[model samples]
Target: MTEADFLQLPDLAARSLGGAVVYANDEFFASRENLISPGAPDFDPSEFGHKGKVYDGWETRRRREPGHDFAVVRLGVPGVVEGVVIDTAWFTGNYPPYASVDGVNLEGYPTYQELLDAAWEPVLDRVALKGDAANAFVVDDDRPWTHLRLNIFPDGGVARFRVHGHARPDPAFLTGTIDLAALENGGDVVACSNRFYSSPRNIIGLGRSRHMGEGWENARRRDGGNDYVVIRLAGQGCVDHVEIDTSYFVGNAPGSARLSGIPNGDAMSDEPSWVELVPRTALLPDCRHRFRVDSPTPVEFVRLDVYPDGGIARLRVNGRLI
Candidate 1:
């Protein structure tokens, strides 16, 4: 019964009849927390969290500044509103060369001929997109909008924000959703099997040794971690690397491997935990699908140890999860 008594959102006509209300605004793209976007499904960005947003000021400074990041809501609830979907799966903000709102006075212009003398209409169809790769304008055309007004300029970043139409049970439509592996236990590793690629001329015995048995042998270059493969992004993020495929391996495709994780330090236990292994890329045995594991400080679990050749078949988490 909070989040402003469930976004009572401009009170969508005092609610009740049919329900719907989806508003989010913590700026920083709705405070991203596990939101991957690419062909979706099994879509793991690391899980996701933080279920609270809906700005217009004060909630301890609703994302503070730049007009408190913006988020005026008031979705429908009393039937017949028709359409309204605006999921930018993940979008950030930083526009000011031009902008417009008028009634609410968001007007700002400095170029584009003063933004066509201040007309501003296409806020990119109101905004929506999910990302891990393979992207496109997810939604913004489905229009009905009882009342919304994102508007942010001074660094914004969002992850997900669905609001399909058909109104009826306004419990504030429960805002964004992100579940991070049911909340922690990324330990008993389970998937990322049989991937391939290698050939300096078939580069000696390299076929997953009949099924990952013989010293787990599948070497390409060789560094140490006895090959590589690890994931823990059931939560936490800001990572930006990881995508791999060799088409099935054997030789001369080893140039990079070794990535560690967990580093926000001081959960304390004798304190020495500060893992971080780097080596983003370099295994282009003619490349195949995708690979990245660059970090900018924000982790939860990840380990890709394969000095010479570990093995892989599928692993992607461009954002969200941890």
Candidate 2:
């Protein structure tokens, strides 16, 4: 895959879904948690402390002796990494000159020592990096990874480490009814009409919206066309129920919404025919609406259409895998 292709992949390390930097060999200058901070890195020239300049990312002390510094991160979801973005934004001089990444697939919780001893496979070989820039790298491996180890040569600072990949859900976990549209469950927002205020992908994110910012919101549409988002399920399934939440969208919630489903095997074309699952129904602001699906046909994808454009907090598609 090309460097541009990395832009299309999902950031598997976004903090919104609980991705974390679990372990690090050293973080003397900056916190490791900053490596997975949501959104872009920020900088304030005068934002300095006693330790050093306050950076918006992981910064280790300069290596005077021995091996390089490293940090281990648990992915938000187990998936095949397609690329990575190691941003050194706002860390021009203190940024590491070179870096490498490795991956592992072990399940369950392992100790830091155990993780260090795990059989790690290289995802990105030692590569040069540019300071104060988003360093993008393509991962050729197709293996599903649960964790990642980032090694910085001779130690320094890194603004962010983004693992971009496609989710790979295990079929064995699809035993009972589950939120097939949940991001943690491997569902993906493949396409969307608008995401002016917030990302459409947030509608399928794990857990309820903690605040208005955690949900998806679109700009006010002056045109006639309504905003919509298409979601590819974790697997082909028969949708049993659907939940549409507009919490924290008191003044800008959609007037009404509709749901459609497409059966498996059909390519997601620009204008694929969709079978109606939920008819046009009115929605109230800051409320949750649940609907039972009457359609019996199993579907691989579902599209949610909000009437005349507005914001939606969350969308849950409860279904059983086919």
**TM-scores of all predicted structures:** 0.20, 0.96
Error of 2 at 100 (Å): 0.6
lDDT of each: 0.34, 0.89
For model 2, state the Cα shift of residue 219 in Å: 1.8
lDDT of 2 by residue, 1-322 (tens): 8889777768887777668899999999899999999888889998889898898899999888988999999888888999999999998889999999999998777888899999999999999999999999999989998899999997999999999998776667767999998888888888899999888888998889988888999999998899999899888888899999999999999999999988853536767667788999999999999999988888889989999888899999999987
Candidate 2 lDDT at 9 equals: 69
For residues 249-289, write the lDDT of model 1, one tens digit per residue: 43444455555665552322354354663555565543444
TM-score computed on alpha carbons, candidate 1? 0.20
Q: Which window of 10 residues has the lowest lDDT sum in candidate 2?
A: 264-273
Candidate 2, clashing residue pairs?
A: none
Distance from true location, Cα of 177 in model 2, Å: 0.2
